[model samples]
Target: MSNLERDPQEIRCGTEAGERSEVLAGREVPLGGPRAMKVSRTLPNVHRRMIGAWCFVDAYGPEVAAMRVPPHPHTGLQTVSWLVEGEVLHRDSLGSLQRVRPGQLNLMTAGRGISHSEESREEVLHGVQLWVALPGDRRHVEPGFEHHADLPVVSRPGFTATVVMGAFGGALSPATTHSPLVAAQLAVDGPAEIPLDPAYEHGLLLLDGEVEPLTAGPLLYLPPGRDALRLSGRGRVLLIGGEPFGEEIVMWWNFVGRSHDEIAAFRKEWMEGEGFGVVEGFDGTPLPAPALPTTRLKPRGRAR
Candidate 1:
């Protein structure tokens, strides 16, 4: 989904030191207008910015609501769409039209630029929309889209892990990733231990039920050096991590660029219908880019 805020804040993101585990709570943000659906934004928090290459994270509804996001532009990022409940129809500039349901993944690579829309006829929608900041070398690659209906699943004695992206439990997902990242959905039945890569910093978001040492509405961030995670509870959670994103990024509205001039140019291109192509199937008109801030955008290191 797009960052529909009228006055979006510019975020300068870089790597941070995480020596220990921390629980970071999310602030609620509305998606669109007055009746917009509110999502719990956890990734770009004040306490922590980027978790590896995984930059933006928004977890939304198991409640009754309709999602109608108009066609919007994106660049220097990849959108990872995962649903736990309900269904959503996705339309993009590449002429790809697909419906993503629970257990399925919709990965869109907005390498240079791309436009897309998401709509759901279902009464209730529940899912998480994530953005992976593309590294410097691959940021300008051609944009594309992928939909995976069957992903690898690792079933242990106490839990079942669905590998949404990257490698987990000796199983790897087919979804393409630009970095050494890992994303999985863990359905914990009782006590379970999850192995981890000591090189990557990880974060866990509780989706449902009660997980020991983890409550809903907050993300549990585990810094590098941990080899495993132990949990004894019945619940579902999303685990995401990777090698810390080393480069600084300026994120304003829907575009992720390097500087204020670059972002302003992107906005100008989108407004003039230049780089990001037309999204054909969406009924509504494309979303207009929000006005830039009065001052020049500045880059800052990661939040610690």
Candidate 2:
């Protein structure tokens, strides 16, 4: 899903301090038009720009609506699409067309650059759209897409976890990643103790039902160190974590880059129809890049 905001904020994201836990609540943001579908944006919070390399996160739906997001460009990041309900048809510049449903994954690597469109194939949509800032060494590798219909699942007494991006309880996802990270969807039954990587900082977002000590809106951030997450309740939640990103990033609109000039160049290419290849199949025109902020963009480090 695109950032769709007419005046999107320029986010300077950095690594986590690896100190204590924090709870970041999401704010409601509309996706498109007047009667837009609203999503709760949890990452890139004023208090925290990122949880490891996980830069942006938007959770939406369980409400009735049709989502139509036109072709939008992205650079220096990978898009991770996961759904709890409904289906989304994805088409991209690489000439890839795939329909993603519950229990499936759509991973797009906007290496140097890539463009894509998303349309709801069902009325009620419930899911999260996330972005991982690629490290400098891998940021310009190549633009690509992956549709994983079968992913590893780890079952415990109180919950069942579907590994979406990285590894969990020895179960690893087939989706390729640039850095050491983890993303999983947990279906909580009663009470459970989930292990954690002492080296990777983590964040948990409750999607539905009730997970004790965790409600259905805010993202719970767990800094690296001693492990294990103990929760008692029945609900659904998303867990994402990674080694604290060693580098800082400048995020504007849909693009992620290092410096102000780098971002400016990306915007120029998108508006001029250059770098990012064209995304066919969508009936509507591509989304226009938002205007740059008057001041130069800067990188901010470790949101302590």
Candidate 3:
């Protein structure tokens, strides 16, 4: 029997109810290219505040872009860049330069601060960039880097799951964080249900093909509640969640934090040109200015 064919009640799951929702809305920003732009379509918190500590989710570069962003600064948050297709070269002020392709995960914990930039080498670069809000106590800690070459990749029946952070089933990632979170990807087809825990908040992005609740349009945010969810139809899906971050978090552009003042200060520093303080070991150039939005931060109301 396929792993997905097993009992849905017993399958290990995240804390969020495994429910599906329709892709309701999306916001797209043309990132200099006529076609290549930043799309904030997924993530329930995209237009608002944090849903369980996950903030500032962006999916870009399914198309070609002539321009690539240079080195930029970041502070008070952990930045994650995962590729689904194409390539991205990341250089930081700390002198770390890494070329990441698909199946590779780049996690930067800017505890105290750091500066970095992702430049696409080819015409097309597509992937997801997530900004995870750090706890106040760990916000100003030292910076670090964790890259996995032989990370565990598990396949079960209709799906393949990647353990990028925290733990999943019996496998676990080496990366450490203050919260209990799991980053996963699912590639599947036909009708199937994914069982999840009731304690964790969850969200899913349909990378290709289509599914109920989440059409191949935008990101779907699933609130915490039930223990299992069934995704019918076919295609591939990327799921990420864990214990819902209970803290109230705020997000503005690429910055995420628990307090508005902290975000404001980050803006002041960013405007003043103070990016995340890079590590001392990586081989790279200094940080550059961020690709700021054309307008100030918009109020997206409350998290659902």
Candidate 4:
């Protein structure tokens, strides 16, 4: 299973079984930064699909001001930051500091936890910040860093695909993970359609331009076991989903785990001086406490 290419069918099967909640596009939150940049929180406190093992997605900007934020800390997670327009510099305590421009991707695995900061260069910044939950088995591993520049993008007869993680269209990212997950960027001019594995469930984020959802608007969820999906008009899409975890995942605030008690213990440790790691030369930005759910009950009905 380690070296064999995953059958898209098997992947799709796992996706359906792990099906939970769909993303309801929410209002944009203005992040007061270099230029009062705004952030759209797509899927939170719910299940995320279309990319392998990943459960969260957020798109940052086509910013006019250079946005810079002080370094912060994170643990038991891997952050995939992809620049879409400008350049952003990342510095960490692990002696890893680099500037990433458009088309470059920075993959930071905060195993056992680590602290870091990202800031815009001369002008402004625009990018996507993706958070992928780490399997329980690998959460305590040592931290690591990987960088890819001008990754060989795949452009077939009808679509353009950029594989940021896992394998897609015969291309893959260097970063390894405990689960099978694929993140791809698809751009289409006019109408184009691609076959979907009956097993894999997926979602599309209209990052820029405009796209017509073949199914319908105000979409709640796209089901599994389908032949293919088509997209038309002039626009771009961020396709994310993957095989779902067979077990339940407890997500509180920014922490994801199998046990709420386990996350609570980690949070307690983080609040004290017992940090897992620190970002070198980084002016640590205090992490806001995660907002607890209003009620313990989960929302019923399809995504709206």
Error of 2 at 141 (Å): 1.0
The all-Cα superposition gives candidate 4 an RMSD in Å to the true structure of 7.8
Alpha-carbon error at 101 in model 2, in Å? 0.3
Model 4: residues with Cα > 4 Å off, grouped in runs: 1-23, 32-35, 45-52, 121-124, 214-221, 283-304
For residues 1-304, what per-residue lDDT tens digits would candidate 2 score against the true structure? 7899888887977754648789998999999877679999998887888888999999998888888899999999999999989999999999999999998999999999999999985388999999999999999989999999999999998999999998998998999999999999999999999989999999999989999888788899998884789988999989999998999899989998999999999999999999999998899999998888988999886584
Q: Give per-residue CA lDDT, model 1, range 97-130, as digits (tens).
A: 9999999999999999999999887478888999
Candidate 3 ranges with C-alpha deviation above 4 Å: 1-24, 32-36, 44-48, 258-261, 271-275, 278-304
Residue 62 Cα positional deviation in candidate 2, in Å, after optimal superposition: 1.0
Residues 198-245 of candidate 4 have per-residue lDDT tens digits of 555566667667666632122234456664677777666676655544
C-alpha TM-scores of all predictions: 0.98, 0.98, 0.78, 0.78
How does each model score on lDDT?
0.90, 0.91, 0.59, 0.59
- Worst-scoring 10-residue span by lDDT in model 2: 12-21
